[model samples]
Target: MDKKKPKKVFVQGAIPPEKIANSIANHQSKTNIGAHSIFLGQIRADEIDGKIVTAIDYSAYEEMAEKVFHEIRESAFSKFDMTCCHIYHSLGKVKTGEICLFVFTSSAHRKVAIEACNYLVEEIKAKVPVFGKEIFEDRTHQWKVNK
Candidate 1:
């Protein structure tokens, strides 16, 4: 096993396309990994009940969110032989069809990369304190991931 330092976790106000692409590029340079898996989560304008979602407002308990994100990074390292990992999530309002979360993972083999990416994403969603509001086209709103 190589003594590789973990990548930083970015919980930001908004993340642009370049940042996501750059993160993947950054991780690629460090790993001799043959496989890299990336997951980008974008908002969708979907009708919930009768309201069509027009935008998303993301809010987080920042201190806890960062704490959880770091835990995820460490967990990913412990669970997989991954070469590197990067995670970024938006913190403010993101319009319809905009990306809100990005997860990148790389490994020496394809299987580990894929599994680690999925696991990391799932853990973040399940444990993180980030909240999102779904704003409808009619100007009404509802919280996302309310469950």
Candidate 2:
């Protein structure tokens, strides 16, 4: 992985399970990495005020969000002894039980991978300029707030 180059982080819709599997498989030849930590953020069927959420339509200022994602990756690399890191988030509608975000961190040790993965997830949620509209089963929608 090129540590200095910015990576593409956005996917058009829900992240595919095959992509996640391929990522892990591709890393098998990197003998130096002894551990990997992964985080998958799935949309939930949340109930609020008698309405049930069916999906989330995510949107973002792509250019700005990519910049922030690069900064977060750089920060993680500086703080953790990680060998590789990857982050992908959905750009369109993702239904309940579908993955909207995927974060993977690899390191020589389990703790570093785990900690870096956690850091990346938290930073992305707090710093990225992404927005989501929660779509209810009745077709009503409301802006989502990251909690």
Candidate 3:
């Protein structure tokens, strides 16, 4: 029987840190990885000018988001000497200080893992078709695509 390659991409709704950690551990065990780097993005309650953001409503052009995310994974693999990658972003509502995105990368060495993690996060932020709604303390909301 042929062994399956480690997951090249992971996309989900409201991914938890524990789940992401588990996936990373499982991938590390399957591959002889010497390093794993992770990026965790959290929602912040901040006052943008005069508006205070209270919570976030996350939505995606699901088909387009998936397509873009997969393309990013493939490109990351091609560009970096990494063994595996995972990308997860929240759906529906995510409150302040909760996780919104998690990107994990494992490689045979620390340098590649670190660089790949950074690159993957930047690429995803720039390319994914996910949109976020900033809910203010006054109960008003505004949708903004990540920039």
Candidate 4:
């Protein structure tokens, strides 16, 4: 039996807008898909304790993260009637307003695609072992925690 290989989720830096557009464009050939949902995670310039965040530096245990990502994909496939799914997350530094993560899902209907897209993003955030360092304007940094 043939199986689809797991895709590499980590990118070197910020996910470009063009990449996201290209992904959508590439799916136009699939005639069965009627809906597509996309989620984009962008770094915010947040202020805390008199410091302002300028960027976010991300890192992860690649082996473990890849395994978790695969698991998430499998779970989504089993849970939803999804036609396709794609996830891309950035490593290294992503400046404020830059995209750090992208999740795309397609299905025959709108609800399935939207829910699957949301599920993928939530699972990636809650399950993946990715860490972020919030870099401040003063060149100082602190670890980020998801709320």
lDDT (Cα, tens digit) per residue for candidate 4, span 1-147 = 115678899999999999999999999999999999999999999998999999999999999998889889989999999999999999999999999999999999999999999999999989999999999999999999886
Off by over 4 Å in 4: 1-3
User: How many residue pairs clash per model?
Assistant: 0, 0, 0, 0
lDDT of 2 at 78: 91
RMSD of 1: 2.8
Ordered by lDDT, highest first, the candidates read 2, 4, 1, 3
Each model's Cα RMSD: 2.8, 1.6, 3.8, 1.5
- Over 4 Å off, model 3: 1-13, 145-147
Error of 1 at 3 (Å): 13
Q: Give the per-residue Cα lDDT of candidate 4 at 38.
A: 96
lDDT of 3 at 39: 93
- What tens-digit string does per-residue lDDT give for candidate 1 at 1-147? 334454445555556888887876676566487999899988889889988998888998777788788888888899999887888888888888788889988889999999999999889989989889899998899888744
C-alpha lDDT of candidate 1 relative to the true structure: 0.83
Q: What is the C-alpha lDDT profile of model 3 across 30-52, one tens digit per residue?
A: 65788889899988888886998
lDDT of 4: 0.94
lDDT of 4 at 105: 97
Q: By TM-score, how accurate is candidate 1?
A: 0.88
Candidate 2 structure quality by residue, lDDT tens digits, 85-124: 9999999999999999999999999999999999999999
Clashing pairs in model 2, backbone N/Cα/C closer than 3 A: none
Mark the 10 consecutive residues where model 3 has the least summed lDDT: 1-10
